[model samples]
Target chain A: MADQLTDDQLADLFAGLRADTVAAVLPPGADAARHTVRRRRQARAAVTGGLAVAAVAGVVGVAVAGTPAAPPAEPTGPLPTADRSALRDLAESVLPPDARSAAAWSFSLGDETSNTAGELPAGSYRMVVACAGDGGTDVLVRWTPRGEDNLFDPERAVVVATGETACAAAPSPATLRFVTPRDGEVMVSVEAVDGAAGRAGFAYRIVPAR
Target chain B: MALTTDLHPPPETTRAVPDFDELYAAHYADLTVQLFAYFGDRQEAQDVVQEAFCRALARWSSVSRYDDPVAWVRRVAWNLAVSRWRRARTALGFLRRQRVAEPQVDGPSPERVALVRALATLPGVQRRAMVLHYLADLTVAEIAQREGVAEGTVKSWLHRGRAALAVQLRPTGTEVSRG
Candidate 1:
């Protein structure tokens, strides 16, 4: 049956299906969507801001009593800075104590790949990638020996290692360990594997392997 | 003053960000349609897509800078649809035992209904592969990357899904002989 039907025929069928579905459903207007989002953001900020203030007050009270106060969690403030710091901390937490940072990058990861590269001497290293977002997209991490120029050329460069980590509020870092054959430039790239379009605050670091 | 302003003109970095309203208006209906085909519920599909847009709006400052910001909204919407469908499936199972009658809505064309039903028969991975390939117009390599599977795996899923749909939708007397 499949041999009898052409690719165009199947595509037409699916296209028709989409058209029919669209006719049956009416999506909300952009203004409505924006209003709802703004309201939700305000509500969430109110709740989280209240909690953060209470937590800080508790820590200050403890210090006033002359108790040996533990270090307080990072205060939440602006969205971009807070997310960057949180993702950086998450990426750093996965590194070994003796690991020295070679290169680090922070970016808003979408469907397109994000890359960061640096020169390194001959040594074993660990690459850690972390992402945080509202969606369930997973970030794929690929390490290649050549610069970005040859990153896509299979003949010119071979991918050393690959791993993936989910994008979440509390993300599990993806780590890859590989040894450089010779001292040269190396590139690491990250992209969302899931087809859905969403954005995440992503941070990655390269450190000496213990 | 005019010469100095022309020389500097402030930074154009913010120009890279896309307009949220335009993006939302352009993609809302199409994304809802895709989600509707994935799960056989139009209202749920619209709701999930709306929720995804809402999430994107909350983080527009960063999301708008992405190379393909619409892709982010699409992914988030699909993720929401998948999770919601899972929860609905569980509740539906219990409701079936109680013989609950579902609310009636305007129906789709018979052919569309048949295609969706055939798609529903497929495994989740195969269905997703079919939808992404056929509807989303993604290449085999793109589908493989999205699914975290090899190209061969994605090809196999698409082949099997097409075969299953053909078997289900083929007419009783239709047959073609290979040369």
Candidate 2:
């Protein structure tokens, strides 16, 4: 009688015998998806981390301290339409000579649907731009220069802000060539919507881009 | 800018959340008791089976499409158990190397440990077939379909694996077969 049981019979007997035992074996179904924004952010940062850095072997005949790595610059505020055109100017000014008038870029800002256009010089690069804000209006810019197109400089300033008038002071039209010496800091003078001239200075400061 | 992606992804992913209740109702105890007999350690086997089942349920949308769910679950459960053994092999190597200038391991030798470890080293399918026969109480025809093999092939391997397991289970005999 013991060995004569068919597979279905055995399965049925197992179901009858161990229903509670099986339930006991199941995992304590905690919400694997539940986490605070802080935990979520922490998880993202852990991805691809702990990679042991290996020194590249090459002979440049002379070697100094290897290229210094810097933390990613924090994102700034949302770029308005005018800020966008200014960003194009910034990217253009920052990109090398061959890449100056000829580079492709992708821009996302405001609530409007957006995309990148124009043939970016060297034909190879990945760039993402957005309005950065703490749920407020702001502009965010991120880009990777690589292969032949890696000539884009990470240090360039295209606009100046003094008081509430941003991008108000443009250099001489003829002097507007791709390169110009950055003369002064973009003095950000934030005040209430209706405030007097040179009251207390802005509560916030925008550091001049390198 | 805050850019958030769903860590749990969409319905099309292997990472989709599980329907834990339904899976529990379906296969929990059968797999646990079965794995317990297979590994001869009920609590550890239960744990490994639970983890593997949770993993399976987490990835059910993808793994459910496999040809043999039982075989799949058993393989995952078995690997989780054997992983401890693979780790333990290094301990054996260290103990062996201690013979360079250390006290001898004296006793009526622990040949049983070597026998069990040797049984574990066989190809997973042969081992599973043997397990289903002895421990799970499944016939050759039952094992054929469960393991997704032809009936004739199942009988052939079961015959061979039985001989091997018998030798491992009993040290003094010249192996026996009954078909």
Candidate 3:
């Protein structure tokens, strides 16, 4: 009998089903509603943009991986070995005087295993650093500052073109600090060859002073 | 530099707009009910519908005059629900650990609840077609136009949706439950 019901009968059945009227919960005001809408729309836009950037990066990563390449050149200098403790120390030293350690970890170069230091609240500048030997090879530090709400910044120049370097000498060790001035929650990542990449980590808070 | 600039949300619109209060009064309850059926969660339904209305209010100057302003709200609300459904389910699982109270449920009959649950099990396309067809009173052609699908596809969805619903809603005994 249920299957035999005509379309009209089915429609009528649903239409006739009585439902309790939901109490009207009008928005605070039109202005407030407008702000809410604007914020949500902007958030959605950010997510969409972030996904697009991720896609581009993914494609670039694929293309780079596909091409045959020479092995990364060894740093022809009396540089310190890219060990964990040294990398951790170098990354930690760059923190602003007020910057408390939010989270920290070490990674071996070419491990391709990334670590998220931890989360930062909304509307914060996230400064990340990749510390390694002065191998002078390119290090890619990428991060997505994503909120608990999943909003993310995708367009940030996570890795400047391979040749565009941001390295600083740290005794025998060298560092690449990718200072991502951003808002909302974010995750950071660093990648390099087995010998060049060291540790990538970050610290952040809302209204982080410099 | 290009990436940093792109992160900034576009400038807000500044122009004459419609009377959002009046529009909200006209559409909020109905949109909420439609979405409640769509999501099988009244709180999520209301939240997404309210969000859609707020968005409509934001672009009232442009959206108010569309041939069907309500459709715009429904489309946005549905999209929001789909996106939220994935993330919210995961987040809610964690929130449940925190012992957050679930939203208050509107009273519904046992049969209706069963039916809605069955409806929820349908694929997204079929569910959307059925909701627009049965709840929203949208014609198959209208759904086709709105969803940017062929009319035949809409018809197929409605047919498949009905077939699945019939099995789910089929009677089990001599006692027939009235719709």
Alpha-carbon runs more than 4 Å astray in model 2: A1-210, B1-19, B64-71, B92-126, B133-153, B161-179
Displacement of the residue B66 alpha carbon in candidate 1, Å: 1.5
Candidate numbers, best TM-score first, in rank order: 1, 3, 2
True contacts kept of each: 0.36, 0.06, 0.17
- For A1-210, candidate 1 gives per-residue lDDT tens digits of 344456667788898987777676666877887788555444332222111111110111100001112222222223565555665465445433433788776665443455566677767776555555433222222234534444433223434554434444555455556666666666665543222123346666667776
lDDT of 2 by residue, B39-153 (tens): 4344566677766665454334334544445455666676556544344345554753453234324311234233334446556667667557654567888788655579898
Candidate 1 off by > 4 Å: A1-5, A49-210, B1-15, B94-105, B172-179
Predicted model 3 interface RMSD: 13.7
Best by TM-score: 1
- Worst 10 contiguous positions by lDDT, candidate 3 chain A: A59-68
RMSD of each: 13.4, 19.7, 18.1
Please give the TM-score of chain B in predicted model 3. Answer: 0.77
TM-score of each: 0.55, 0.33, 0.47
lDDT of 3 by residue, B1-179 (tens): 11111111223245444466877767776677677667776667778887777756644444554556678778768766765665456657576334324433545655656666777899978987888887787899998987668999999999998877776666554344469
Per-prediction interface RMSD in Å: 13.1, 17.2, 13.7
In TM-score terms, candidate 1 sits at: 0.55
User: Candidate 2 chain A: minimum summed lDDT over ten consecutive residues — where?
Assistant: A168-177
Alpha carbon lDDT at B24, candidate 2:
52
